[model samples]
Target: MKKQTRAIASTLIFAMLLGVTACSKKNSNKSKKKFSVATQAETTEAPSETTESTTESTTETTTETTTEATSNPLGLKIDVPQENCEIQFLPEEERFKYDMVLELNEADHTVGGHVVVNFYNNSSEEWNQLCMRDYSSLFKEAHHDGFQEIEVKEGALTEVTNVMNETTSQALTCNRDADVSVLWIPLDQNLKPGEHMTLSYDFKATIPLVADRYGLSDGVYNVTNFYPILAVYEDGKGFSHEAYYNFGECFYSEISNYHVTLTLPEKMKLLSTGVENTPANADGKNTYTIEAPCVRDFVFCASENFKFFEDDYDGIHIRLVYDEAHPCGDTMDACAEASLQAAKDSFAAFNKAFGKYPYPEVDIVLAPIDAGGMEYPNLIICTVDAMYCLTNSYESFPYEQMAIVVAHELGHQWFMGIVGNNSGMEPWLDESFASYTEFVFYEYLGVEDEMELYSRETFDLTKEPWLTSMQANGILPINRSFYDFEDADSYILAAYSYGKIALYQMEEILGREAFHGILREYVHRNAFTNSTSSRFFGVLLECAGQDNADLNKLIEVLFDI
Candidate 1:
């Protein structure tokens, strides 16, 4: 989710970095390390998985064809090369895949689905059992009957585990509740490294009517992390079974291919993570199929009253959907255009500085929420309040605020979406990069002065006073898990505010061009893989020159390592 005030605080700190003359002396000793920008010709690659053909119209017909087929159901050309379309970081032998079919009941506010997973035991040790997370339980805890009826189909040997209740002590602060998210599936055979296994299960849940990520709110159904996804299995550390925290994202998953079919009422409009393929309508229900490769997660939003608009920029299709009766209708239309333009402009800037966005389209939706925004792989959900100032005059909408949120979420398409990181552990890796990208957006627009004023106003209202108040209370280290923070405010301050400041300081030491070059190289090397703080620091040190003790010192101070 977008940390609205934190973005402004980060931009203000970046502006402060420009005036730090003391850091100029260390920059004269340039490193000899070479970094080259990737050419457009190098971006084309084939998908690692085989393509399957499916029917798209009302009559459900089946056909066998490759992605090279000239005509697609959507009438849009499938021109992105297969290799460039899918993530190439993982070896074919070690890749995991998911095939799911979901049916949505709009009247009951429920979803029923089944997923088949082909999982590879990539870890070195033999495994006796596997674990997956049941995030819907978190929602169930609050609205007892609302998020109910999750069954692991009779054929699957999976059961809910309450191991946390049995093993943990009272002193532990995180995830102390009785409802555990981990689901243990006993393996009939001991699976060794490089071995593959297939598992299938059925699940159903009632969507809560709340203004949160995974729920139904204001006549729109927002589905995210609703299905049971495989938990990350660390080589030496075992499966990560951390409970879902309330403040920040606690999700960590490997890039995988997805084939999802959602059956819903015929009149509902849908926006999902992947590209929509052949859709068929039968009786009162419509079946929509989507195929996405190399995405970490899949999500969708459906509403019968949504008004849709479309545009294209730099070979990427951009679309916006919103409720027509919204209080900020006129302003939202204007903000949507401005936000989409900002996103397109930022994409070009980021592609030059980092890496190209591999996806074919991006969907931006005006969701009914009171905060900033939320980011998915190729989709972004911006809150209504961020699109327009609710209390201010309608003539002057919150275009700048909406633009910052749009650019920030777009930045995640690279930092978090393409270059993966553990959000629960090191959220700064993505949030800080996203915040810095917002600064780049303003710089690209040549509105640094306007950004400064906006930043100052937000900083004054939130960070400026909070920092002074917390200075006496002692601040936590910036590089730590979300659980380490005392509250949402502390998390925002450390992860978003201080985190971007650290990057901006690093940018000051290395020139802007060199800094951008380093990030570009980093994204290229670590695309579709999880990155750690050590590897990030090592890359910086290598590019800045090992002999540059001052840069290392600054890193040590900022990251507290």
Candidate 2:
């Protein structure tokens, strides 16, 4: 398996690699709404000593006004503690190490607690910061008022393995758009350039009863916004996170080591974020071990019954697990295979088109959730039943539906996974592209007019002028946009309809060879780095050269802001 892949370039992206499996339960919907908290008493020595040492640690409460710009996406919020927080994690547990570790410098203090951030180098030489919306629900109903400031003597590193006092809760008590005080800890710790360090923290998250957009249904974990993952930090061009909350986009993160240990009921088998290192074991309980390096955040889905189907593609081991009892089993399998094939095809194409596949394994699962599909690094979770309903109008699985959905999910390997976009903002970047590619599977299979038919089906949804560029009807970010969709319909429209149309148009103007050549060049250059629509257009325009007026016009109509 070519696991040494480069960083993806899109801001609108799914979390790290996603794995797929099916579980049988009343409500298989995974929990998306969650809140985490971890607490710790400082034991590590301060880097510096100050007169404040004589004062009671908990007695002082610093006050400062917090000003935050409204986020385009309405749901989440990101706040970083100014005081340097020492983050921690180990290989033994499942959840992340901590909420944050704060080393307060009287000179570099923040309003309250500093937000803990984990960074990763997708493919770039430097690490980028991720951006998130504010979730102030953490502030209210807290056992601890705020953080206890510790003086880090100049040049000394103070480590506080902080944990959240509140482990479970959904939706911030604060409004989604509300601005709250947050502390930011700079990764630019005075350490020399190119230096790496571990920032760990612990947090307790409550699975919300109703995860408005992303949360728990019944007891299953359909989680996404469980913790305060880091936000992208910009040099000057605003946040590296995307501007519009479109269906797909690129994201940035700081590179750091992740050692997550989650403690849960022994009856549960955890299908988590990265590849598994330790086999499931019983110590009066059952647990699986995982170790991922340079991951931004950890995500896991635990279910009692995970029907695992394992296979290998190009010598790379792939596992597809899901609930056998699901109504859409036959369709799911077909889609799964198609998706797998598409992924392999995309990888092969990328090698010729762009580069090589990065990781050793790719996992695809069928979540019992309502939303159709979600993509992570090597894993992707797609709602099989919903997928069946969205594209396969027939009650049964048709070869075409299987091919299209599978191809779409597989397309994520390039558009979303390898390219890396912020799914929260630029929904179209990867979705549309992936959709277009998904239909290409038909062409590959020698289906008649498959691309045209697929394009027509997709465009039919957004053909209305109101749907283009209008906030109410225009595409929304992947993360928040799912709300607007009832099933898998939106994905088809975004990925195949708009994205395919645009890509096909480009190919027409540039010639298939030249159009594909531009893609190859763009992917090769970006490899693992995060990118945006503008960047893609720039590269394509350059590849197409100045002689192509049609290409230029198409670029303007489709991508010009």
Q: Which segments of model 2 are wrong by more than 4 Å?
A: 1-198, 209-214, 217-220, 223-225, 237-257, 280-282, 293-297, 325-354, 386-399, 453-496
lDDT of 2 by residue, 428-525 (tens): 66776675564343333333242443232344323454246423433333223323433333443443345566676566555554555566556545
Question: Per-residue lDDT of 1-561 in model 1, one digit per residue for the tens?
Answer: 555433334433453343222112112332111001112312332211211211121011111222121232321122112211222334444457889889988766777677777877878988877777767656653432211222211111122222221111111112222545676665656678988777776777666667656677767877877777888888888888775764467788888878899998988888888777657989988899987766888888888878887755434566788876666666666666656655666665676566556666678887765346778887888776633346542234334445666777888888888888888888888887887786665555444443333342343322456355545323345667766666566667666665665566566566555676667656656777888777777667655666665566656545655
* lDDT, candidates in the order shown: 0.62, 0.40
Q: Lowest-lDDT window of 10 residues in candidate 1?
A: 30-39
Misplaced by over 4 Å in model 1 are 2-94, 143-177, 386-398, 449-476
lDDT of 2 at 406: 49
lDDT assessment of candidate 1: 0.62
- Model 2, residue 465: distance off in Å is 9.5
Q: lDDT score, residue 157, model 2?
A: 15
How many pairs of residues collide in model 2?
144
